[model samples]
Target: MYKLLIRPLLFLFDPEKVHHFTFSFLKITLRVPFISTIVSRLYQVKDKKLERNLFGLTFKNPVGLAAGFDKNAVLYNDLADFGFGFIEIGTVTPKAQAGNPKKRLFRLPKDKGIINRMGFNNKGVEAAIKQLKNNKKKVLIGGNIGKNTQTTPENYTSDYTTCFKALHPYVDYFVLNVSCPNVSSHAKLEDAAYLKELITEVQKINNQQNIQKPILLKIAPDLNTIQLDEIIDLVNQTKIEGVIASNTSVNREGLKTSTEKLDQIGNGGLSGQPIKEKSTQVIRYLAEKSNKSFPIIGVGGIHSAEDALEKLEAGADLVQIYTGFIYEGAGLVKQINKAILKA
Candidate 1:
């Protein structure tokens, strides 16, 4: 119904507007009696075979909602009803800032992809904390945190530490993001030396707490083998739990979208199908290079069960969906889980 009906309709309006509308619609409809129950029955898959224990937390399954979609924590419970084993909230910053202006999100339907320069626009950490504290479900949540847009790399660790301290109690795991192409100078933190220092500083704070949450890095798909090797070494050195093997890609190579239209769309991280292969390649490289030394959460352009399987086969311990959920609808999650069972 989504591809043939709902998606076609939703695709007509501005992508950002439709995103908010869908959230509002779900929030309102979910309030009706038995709605959540019915949705859960239709979408949820219960199977002990799919359970996974990684980074000290157990996931009901490997499918997760990637960050950026639920930039804040508002719709995590509602989204979880759609059969996700876990949900990752935010590329949230220390301070809430209006991201890049209007039209920051673009859909490339022909390519089954999306381009977004939303710039980590989230309602800061405090707002998400309120929602996290209110969470009633036992669903596993991963917090994907980032620095404020205006913050320079020199003092960026402070932003991450602030968010880490604030959200550590609430989220099940943490993803340190420094690969977002939309944020100015964010990539500077991705340098091996800088990343090592940043991760070390965060670890120092994490050690002070009695119970330390697993910390992972959200890297870009654009990294070369040398960079991936350095990251693997850093993970081993820092003893941070894992890595989310890819954020979106800045490369526009081989897109089916028309050049004129893509050019008009301008600069942003290109996600969905265009980056699937690249993401999986990164996962494979990291897994092979490190000899599967640590866990990796795979994400990028997963639009089907096969796509998810490919990620797993390439050595991703868990997989996440952002554009896939947008293109394939919620049923895709259930479908992927069923595929995992059959596999």
Candidate 2:
């Protein structure tokens, strides 16, 4: 129904506008008493086999909604009804700011993909905390934190720490979003030396708390073996929790989308079906190169149960979905969990 009846209708309008509309639609419909119960019955999958014990928290299932989808920390509780084991919210910054100019999000239906340069355009960390205050605890939540676009280079670590300190109590785990291509000054964030310093600072603050939350790095899929080796070293050196391999791809190679059309859309990170193989390869490399030293949350181009299985088989301890959720509908979560149980 989502693919045939709802997706086609939603795809007709501007992609950004349709995103807000869907958020509102879900918010309104889920509030209609028995509607929540019925939706839960249809989508929820409960099996002891589905639980994933990773880091310190035990996930209800392996499937999660990735960060970009619920940017402000809203809708996670509502989305939990659709049987996700966890939901990651935000690439939130220290201060609120309008992101890149309009027409920044595009869809490539031919490749079952999306290109977005949304620029971490989320409400500031404080706003997210306010929304998260009402957390129902129906699902485990991961907070994805990033620097404000206009933040000075000297303050880059400060920005990540600000969001981390503020969201630590609210979210179960934390993902340092240093690899998003849409953000400004992208090069510094990915620099191995800079990343080490940044992760160390976040860890210092995390240690002060009564309970330390797991910290993970979200990396881009464009990294080669050399970079992947650096990532393994970074994980070992920092001793942070795990890695979410990966975030999105800036590589446009082998896309079925026409060159003229892609050029018109301009620069953005690609997600969904076009990135499945690339994402899995990175996962396999990290797992293999590091001898499976750290847990991995696999994401990128997962549009079906087979895709999720591929991620899991490649050594991802848990998997996340952002574009896949948009393209394959909420049923895909239940589908992946069922397939996990079957396997």
Q: What do the candidate models score in CA lDDT, each in turn?
A: 0.92, 0.94
Stretches of candidate 2 above 4 Å error? Answer: none
Per-residue alpha-carbon lDDT of model 2 for 128-157, expressed as tens digits? 999999999999999999999889999999
Writing each residue's lDDT as its tens digit, candidate 1 over 1-343 gives 9999999999999999999999999989987899999999999999999999998889999999999888899999888888899999998889999999988999999999999999889999999999998887758998999999898767798999999999999999999998999988855778888888889988998999989989999999999988888898898888889999899999998988989998899999999999999999999999998999999999999999999999999999999999999999999999999999999
Error of 1 at 236 (Å): 1.4
TM-score of 2: 0.99
TM-score on alpha carbons, each prediction: 0.99, 0.99
In order, how many clashes per candidate? Answer: 0, 0
